[model samples]
Target chain A: MEFKKYSKTLFFGATLAVLAGCGGNDAVTQDDVNASTDGQVQPVITSDGSNGDSAVNGEQLGQEAQNLQDQASSAIAALPEVETVYFDFDTSVIRDDSREVLDLHVAYLNANPAQNVVLEGHADERGTREYNNALGERRGNAVKNYFMVQGVSADRIEVISYGEEKPAVIGHNNAAWSKNRRVEIKY
Target chain B: MPFKKWIKAAAFTLLCVTQQAVADLTIEITQGNDRATPVAVVPFAWLGQSPLPEDVAQIVSDDLERSGLIRPLSRSDMLSLPSQKSEIYFRDWSLLKQDYLLIGQVRPSVSPGVLTIQFELYDVVRQTRVLGEVISGKVSELRSRAHYISDKVFEHLTGIEGAFSTRLAYVTMRKDEAGQNKYELKVADADGRREKSILTTYKPILSPSWSPDAQHLAYVSFETGRPGIFIQNVYSGKRRQLTAFKGLNGAPSWSPDGEKLAVVLSKDGNPELYVIDLNTYKMKRLTKHYAIDTEPEWSPDGERIMFTSSRSGGPQIYQLDLVSGETERLTFEGNYNARARFSPDGTEIYFVHQKDGIFHIAAQELANNRLRILTQTPLDESPSVSPNGSMLIYATQEGSRGYLGAVSVNGQIRYRLPSQRADVREPAWSPFLTN
Candidate 1:
C-alpha cells in the first residue's frame, strides 16, 4: 500500500489535477491507461474501453440563476448571526441549543420583511434516502412553524428537504452526523 | 473497548487497501457460502494470436459462484483440462467429485473484431452433455457473452432464469479536481463491466429507478441546487426533467406499464404521494397526510401502491389501494420499515428493516407474513430485487464510503460489488435486458 501511494504520487507529480477525474468509471483518458500500466502493472479496464464518457455538467447547463447564491450568502453574513439549526436523530422537534439560533433568524426575518429564506432541510446519512427526505422536511417544517410563530409570515419562508444527499461535512460517525442533521437558513 | 477499537482500526485499514488494489468490480462473497454445489469450469481454449481482453471461462465461473448455489472447482484440482468432448475423460472429472463439468473453446470468427465461443456443459455422473451452444460477438462483448453462457447453464440446472445477463444502474461519487464531491449516474453490465456514465455533477443523485422497459432510468438529481426527478435514456444518454416543483420532487417509481410514475412531491407544503402521467404531465395526489408520506412504489400488478408514511407515529410501510383509496399498514414488527419493494410475483415484499439500530434488507411473505432478513450488512437500503425475484442489490456502507451489496432472496448467499475509488450507491438491477 505504501508503495502504491508513492508510485501514484511520483507518476502524478504534474498530473495530480487530472488524476482526480480518473476516478470516473469510463472517463479514464489514454494518459490514465498509460499510467496504470506504466511499471508493467496489470491493466484493469478492458482493452476496448472507450474514452467518450464525457458527462453532462448540470452546473453549466442551468447556471443562469444559481450564479448569484454567493452574493446572497454575503447578505446573510452581514446579519452576524447563526444561520443553521440541527436536530437529534429521528426527531424533527427543535432543541434548546437551536433556540437561540432560530430566534436570531426570526428577528432578522421580522426586521427585513422583504428578506425571504429557504429552509433547506437535511439529515444524516442513515436510513432510506426518501424517508430521510421526509425526516428532513419535517425538520424544515418545524423551523418554519417556529419562525411563523415568532411572527414571520408564511409567504416569507420556503422549505425543501435534501435528505441525506448533501452533507455539510463528509463522514460516517457521530461527529459528522451531529453536524449533518441540520437545516440551513439559505437566503 | 480496546479490542473493539483495534478491530475497527484493522477493518478500516483493510478497506483502504481494498480500495487501492481493486481496479473495477471485485466480487466478495460475505456469508453462507459453504453449501454450494461443487462443479468444474475448465478454462476455454483460446485460438486468437493476441491476448483477449477478458478471461471468458473465469467470468463464467465467477458468475456462477456469485449465485452462491454453484461453486466452481479450482483448475489445479482438475486432473486434466479438456476443451472438447473428444478430449474429456469422464472418470477424471468424477474423481475430482465435480457434479458438473463445463468446457469451451474460443475461435476467431469470420467477422473481424468478433469471436465465437462454443461451450458445452456436462453432467458428470449422468455421463451426458446437458447444455451446449455457440455465441459470437465483438471482442468487447466477450464478458457479456460469457454471462449469456452462464445464464443458459444456470437456468438449465436450477430451473430459474439467470440474472447474469441483466444490467445495473447506480450512482458513484468521487472528489473532483476542485476538491468538491462529484457524483455520477452510470449503467453497467451485471458483473460491473462496460460501465457508461449517464450524468455527472457536483451535486448528489439518488433513487435511480429503472423504467419497466429497461430502456430508461428515473432518478432524483440535485444538480440545480435543488431536487428534481429526471429520466434519461440508457443508450442515447438523452434526458428530460420530469418535475421542478417548489419543494422535494423525489422517489420516482414507475408503474408496471411504464406510462406513469409514482412520485413523492412536497409542492403543497408536505411531502405526499402523487401519480404523474408521463405523456400528459398530469399529476394526481395519492396520499394526503401531514406526517411525511414518501417513497411510493407501485405493485408489480399495478393494482396498489406501497409507500412509507409516518402517520402511524413511525416510519412504516403502508399499502394504498388505487381504486378504493383505502390504506392498510403491512409492517408492524419494526418501527422503521421503509423503501418497500414488491417481488416480481407480488407474493412477497422486500424493504429496509431497522433492527437494533442497524438497517438491513428484509423480506416478508404476503400470505403468511413470514418475515426474513435477507442481508447481514449494516446500513443497507434501497433493496432492488432482481426481476427473477431470487436476489436483490442494495446500497451499503463500509467505513465511510458506500458500496453496492447483493444477496440471494432466501438470505443464504451474499456478495458485494466493491468499487475501486468511487462511493457507489443506489444500485438498481435492470430486468432481463434486450439485445
Candidate 2:
C-alpha cells in the first residue's frame, strides 16, 4: 500500500510538470499525447523503478516501465474520449470496459484535486416514474462508489439522477432504450 | 415558521399561466358492454337567448355514453323533441329499444347572468319517472350543470354515484417556436373541456397529486434546475415549494385527511420514503433500506401506505402500516410492479405492471390477491382512480405522443383523451367538490 501511494504521487507530479511544459494551451494536441508517452512519463517510470541502481542495469528497468506506461497511457487516453457508460436494463453493475474508463477518471481526479465531477444517471422510460427515479439513483451511486474505490475524493464527486424523465434519444424502440440507459460523466 | 415564509411562498406568482377553452374532448368509446342499456337525450328547448352557449343535452349524452354503462341514441333517431315529461310517448322510446329517456330546458333566470336548467330522467320500460331536478348556475356553467344532471341520472340507474362533476389535472408538453420544450400543468373538466393552465415552465413537471378537498395540487417541478415538490392552490393561483431537497424531491402524494404528504426524497443519501406534515413542515423518514424505495401512496383510510421498492430484487408494491411501521410485500406474481394506488373502495390496488416487455395498468384485489391486467396499451402509467371509484385514468402513448386514457374499474369500458397539439400525461382525478 505504501509503495502504491508513493508511485501514485510520483506519477501525478510527473504528469503535472508535463502539463505545465505545454502551458497556456489546454486543448489536447498531438504533441501533448506524444510527449506524455515518449518524453516525461517514460523516463520518470524508469528512473523511479531503478532508484540507486547502475545506468547499465537501467535498460531492464526501462523496458518494464515502458510496458506499464503503455498500458496506463492507453487506458487514461480512453477516458475523456468515452463520455458515457451504458448499462443493461434494470441493472447498475459497471461493465468491464467501464472499469478502464473510470480508472482514467480516477487518475485525472487524483492529479487535479481541485476539480469536481458530476455523474448524471438516466434510464429508459419504462415502469413507474418514481421507481425509475430510484433506479437512476442506484446507477449513479454505483458509478460514484467505483470512483471512491479508485481513490477519488467523495466530496469532489456529486451525483444527480434524471431518472427516465430525460432521454438521450427520443424514441420508443429498443435502440433508443439501450442508448438512454446510461450514466454520463460531466466535469 | 415565520412571517417571511408567506413572502417566500409568493415567489411562484411570477410563473406564466396560459389557458385554452376553445375545444372539449370528443368522446370515442373504444369498448363497452354489449348489454348496455340504450338511452335517448333530446335537444333541450332554448328560451330567452338568441342561441344557447353550449349544447347541454349533447354534453350529458356524451358523459353517459362514455361511462360504458349506458348507450345514448343519435339525435336523428329521436322521433320527437321532448323537453318535458308530458311530451314523451313511452312507446316511441320502446320502438327505438331505449330503456331510458332524458329531456331538459334552459332559460334565462330572474337573477341576471344566471340560467335555470330543468331536466327529467325517465325509465321508458317501466313507464315511470326516475328523477328530476332544477339546477341554477351562471350561463358559463352550462356544461357543469349538464354533468350534474348526468351524475344524478347515473346514480339513479347504476346505484353508483357519478363522477361526472369532478375535474382532472394533467401535464402537457410541446416544443415552442424556439425548438425548446415547454411544459404546462393544466386542469380540465372531467369531460376534458375548458382546460386552464395552472403552471407553465421550460422544465419538466410530473407526479401531480390532488388534495382530498380538490382545492390544491402537489406536484414535482424542476423549475429551479433541480427537482422540488410544490403545492399549488388550483383556484387562487397561490403556490409554495414544499421541499427542494438536494436529490429526488419527487412523487408527492396527499394523505387522505389532507394534513400531510408522502414524498420521495434522497437528501439523506439513497432514495427513500418520507412523510411531511403540512402544518409544521416536519418530515419523518419511513423506510431504512439499502435498496430503492419510493412512490408512496396513502390508502383511502389513511392507515397504511403502499409504495414501490426493489428490496426483493425487483420492483414490487409493498404496504407500510403507518401506525405499526411494519411493511409487507403486496405483489409477487410479476417480476415488475410499481406506481400502485388503493382503489377508492380500499378493496384493490391499481398499479403499472410489466409483462412480455409491455407496461400496462393492473389491479390486485386485496382479499384474494387476484391480479388482473386492465390495459393493453404500451407504456401505460400513472393510474389514478375516480372519486366515485368506478373509473380509472392513466397516461399512455398513442403512436409516439402521450395521451390520457380512461378505463372502467371492471375493464369493460375504455376511452382516450388526446389533445390535437401537445402530449398529455400524469393524470390526477380530483375528489368530489362539495359546495
lDDT tens digits, residue span A146-186, model 1: 66545567767777788998888888778999999999998
**Candidate 1: true contacts recovered, fraction:** 0.25
What residue pairs clash in candidate 2, if any at all? Answer: none
TM-score of every model?
Answer: 0.83, 0.84
**lDDT tens digits by residue: candidate 1, B1-435:** 211111111111111121122345556766545656778999999988997777788888878877877878977788888999999999998888889999999999888899999999999999999899988988777888889999998898788899899999999999888889989998887877667788999888999999988999999999988888999999998899888776778999999999999888766455677887787766676765545678888998899999897765568888998877678889999788999999999999999999988899999999988889877777899999998888899999988789988888887667778888889999998977866
RMSD of every candidate to native, in Å, equals 17.1, 14.5
lDDT of 2 at B296: 92
- DockQ, candidate 2, vs. native dimer: 0.12
Q: Which 10-residue window of candidate 1 chain B scores lowest in summed lDDT?
A: B6-15
Clashes of each: 0, 0
TM-score of chain B of each: 0.93, 0.94
Residue B392, model 1: lDDT of: 90
